[model samples]
Target: MFITSENATPVFKDLTLVMPAVAVGNVGQLAVDLLISTFNLPRVGYLHTDCLIPMAGNNPYATGKDDAGELHTAAEVYTAPELKLAVLQIRAPVVKSKSRRFRQLLLSWIKASGFSRTLVLSSSHAYQRDDQQLQGTPLRYLVTPSLLKTSGDAFKELGWREMEKRAPLCPERLDTGAEEERLYVPGGGITKGLYMDSCTEDVPLAVLLVFCSEGDNVPDAMALVSHLDDWLHLLDNPNREGKWKIPTSWNLLFGSGIPPAIF
Candidate 1:
């Protein structure tokens, strides 16, 4: 269930919710880290459920040494009240059997909270891309029908490319028109599921993702965030190439130091 902090303030209505799908290269999560750290958004609450593997760690967005050790849960919510933005950062993968339950819970909370819209950052395996998909930029976007009317112009202005629906895998299914073109997100964990759910529910949802392989994906994350900034104007700078501050938590991403024995 979704739970708020004891001192959490009421600020859910009409907010734009952003989250990341744990996909190939973890580009989405890293982009979220950049956003939370750069904006210094506060941790407002967390979602407690059996659907996800339980996890806890030091606050990744801690501003200084005093709060460096603050405990953070697997899925935490942070917000920027002024911008009407809320970000849900999930650090752990969902339990395979409970994936559906988790999606239901998330969608229910979003509906109950009355968010204006939702955006998901995700990534897919680069090797799976078609020849046409590999021709240009690796970034692509998808928007539910409910959100198309509102953000369509902005997307066009930014010269963004919408993800193309792929043909079915089975050759026989194509003859009967039983195979409609559908968004296929290979390696995108819960992204396709969540998006399909949103489409069915008529929720205003948009997905921004990149195609990448498994490796150091900090650059891919940066590019994804930069693409978002271009459309949303999330940062203060007018220049599209403005630099974002990296979070302090990244210092320990690979671990704090070498083991004493090894040293």
Candidate 2:
């Protein structure tokens, strides 16, 4: 459920939503962080749902002491009205049993809010990639049919490779010659399910994901957000390099000083 700040409801009609899928290396989340920090979009509401693991902290994007003490929860909503953009940043993993419920909740709100389109940023395990997936760029995309009808031309011009469908491993099913191929996004938490649901429900949605390992995924996040900018043109970097400000909270990524005595 969306609870607006100070009990003030904001209109999201026709806004384009970009959300993160809590998956491998949290690349999607990190990329959303970059977008939020870069744009300095103001927080509008909170997604108070049981679908995610609960967590809280001081404002991660706080620009100074004045805003530094603001309380932040696991899931929050930010919007840049001028850009017609809204972003949902998920800072925690989903509860294992409620994955389906979570997707339904999101779709219900999105449809109710009247977003023009939705984009999910996510990542999958690099090691799971088949031979064809290993070559070229690690980026992949999937668009629901509803989005295809409207954004079809834009996709064609982008020259992007669509996510591949692979046959299942079960021999019995294979022997039956089931002609259907499945969209498998291993390590992409709720990404495949959400896309499938959107397709079934006739929602205009697109997913952009990267293949990456679990180490420090800052670079992977960089690449993913760069691809996003290619489509949305959200950032104003003229040189196509530098200028993205890293958030203040990331300074302590690996925890504390490690006690100088231990060193």
- Top candidate by TM-score: 2
Scored against the true structure, residue 77 in model 1 reaches a CA lDDT of 90
Candidate 1 residue lDDT tens string, 1-263: 77888575557899999999988998999999998988878888888998989898887877789998999999989998887899999999999998888888999998998999999999999999987798799999999999998988888888989898887777565766746776799999999999999999999999999999998889999999988888778886453245688998888766788789986
Question: lDDT (CA) for every model shown?
Answer: 0.89, 0.92
Q: TM-score for model 1?
A: 0.92
lDDT for model 2: 0.92
Steric clash pairs (candidate 2):
none
Instruction: lDDT for model 1, please.
Output: 0.89
TM-score of candidate 2 to 2 decimals: 0.94
Candidate 2 lDDT tens digits, 57-97:
99999889999999999999999888899999999999999
User: What is the Å distance of residue 74 in model 1 from its true position?
Assistant: 0.6
